[model samples]
Target: MEQEKDTKSNGDDVSRLEKYKEELIAIHHKSQETFEQQLSYISAGSLALSIGFVKDIVKDIDCAGYRPLLGIGWVLMVITLLLNLVSHLLAVKFYRKSISEIHRNEFVSSKSDTRFDKITWLNWTCVGTLVLGILLIIIFVNHNL
Candidate 1:
């Protein structure tokens, strides 16, 4: 019957839409993971490079005036790294909670999730701190030079 065909077509469309949504979600998650990993790598690498620069390149130079700036930059970098780690853990927790909710037939909305909000805040904070830390380090080095 034409009616039956229309109903079947509608059902197929709904199923296709669900599959497309799932694929998009997977891609989003993958991109987020990649972003976090890169940020972590950059933060850690910057910290190490700054330390090495101070130890080897500026060893004899008395950067006493700008020492505080360098110290603050180091602190910021550490904080960024810590925040990244915390955000990653919170993301895992959020996903686990979401999975449990799905299993219970409860709809989980990311917009209403405090954990997701925290993760988002932490990620942005990490970006801010990392940029500030790098800027301070650059200023310190330039001033010393």
Candidate 2:
């Protein structure tokens, strides 16, 4: 029957949609993990490299004039690291809340989730601060050289 065929086709479409949704969710989670991990590593590495550069390479130069720039860069890097940590914690809470809501058959969209919003903001802030910190460090090194 044509009607029967139509019903079967609709069911197939629904299942395919569900499969795609699951795949997308998995990819989203993986990308988030990668972003956070990579950013943290880069920020920490930058801090260490800056310190080593000053101690080993710029040892003879009087860095007092541009020291404040380096100090601010260090502070920014620290803040980036702290914000990344807080974002991780918030992400955990968000996932827990999402799971609970799913178990309860209550759907809360990510746009309306405060924890999700905070995580998003924290991620942006971390990137911004890291970039600013790197720029400051570059300026400090240039001045010393």
Candidate 3:
């Protein structure tokens, strides 16, 4: 009777392990997609920043009254870039963690992928800052003109 009970428990464990493997594969694909999406955001943000900077410099608008505003705008943009970088790094970190959990046979489907929520907030903050910076730059340039 004890042997029968042991065999049944082993079968259950094997079935559970198989389910975990299937779930882990899906989680891996999702994590890869998330990482790729984050990289895209970083790349796009870089291009926008570069173009905006070039345009601003080409205009060569110099006004003493708006100098402070221009300075603040530049600072905000720099911060935005830094935050984007941090968010990108966070994506990598989450991917590594997910992989590690899977290897340890401790992966839980419910707890696997939501770590990127913080990255979403960070991305939004980056966008907000970039927009504010552009607005300030526009206001300063227009005022000077």
Candidate 4:
């Protein structure tokens, strides 16, 4: 009878809906944990590493409150910190959509390859400048002394 057929279809729909609902909850739970991990743990590591590097560099510069060398090191540390924050933010935003192949492809498309190249170039430039500045400071101080 048509009534029997209708009842069977309804039961199927109910079971399917329940299954999907459970799957969705699991995906959301995982996404939330991943986001929190990046924002908290990963970012914390970057913060500590950057600050520690600068702190070590400036260990003996307490007397020169306005030392340009220390300032440059601090600037590099801050730049590195900001880059890590941005990367973590991107990873968090993509964590949920990361389930879909299409979404993953979209994420890959959105990020610029050239941007990473430029960052590399800038890093090298900054390092070169730092070395030059240190050499200049040593030369000038040595001559003066």
* Top-TM-score candidate index: 2
Any runs in candidate 3 off by more than 4 Å, and if so which? 1-63
Report the Cα RMSD per candidate. Answer: 2.1, 1.8, 7.4, 12.1
Candidate 1 minimal-lDDT segment of 10 residues: 107-116
Once fitted onto the true fold, the runs of candidate 4 whose alpha carbons sit more than 4 angstroms away are: 57-145
Q: Between which residue pairs do clashes occur in model 2? A: none
Q: Write the per-residue lDDT of candidate 1 for residues 1-145, one digit (tens) a residue.
A: 9999999999999999999999999998998899899998988888898888888878864644588889899899999999999899889988888888888888558544766888889999999999999998888777765
Instruction: Write one digit per residue (lDDT tens) for candidate 4, span 1-145.
Output: 9999999999999999999999997996686446444434433443465346445643454443445644554454445445545544554444444446354565453444443444445434534544444454444333322
Task: Name the runs in model 1 displaced over 4 angstroms.
Answer: 1-5, 108-112
Stretches of candidate 2 off by over 4 Å are 60-64, 110-112
How do all the candidates rank in terms of lDDT, highest first? 2, 1, 3, 4
lDDT of candidate 2 over 40-117, digit per residue (tens): 998999899999988888885464458888999999999999999999988998898888888888867854476687
Q: Regarding lDDT, does 1 or 4 come out ahead?
A: 1
Compare candidates 2 and 3 on TM-score and give the better one: 2
Worst 10 residues of 4 by lDDT: 136-145
Two-way lDDT contest, 2 vs 3, winner: 2
Global local distance difference test of model 3: 0.72
Whole-model lDDT, candidate 1? 0.86
lDDT of 4 at 86: 58
lDDT per residue (tens digit) for residues 1-145 in model 3: 9999999999999999999999997997687567546645654564466446546753554433476667777777778778877887897888788889999998876676568778778878877877787677667656664
Provide the TM-score for each candidate, comma-separated: 0.86, 0.91, 0.58, 0.39
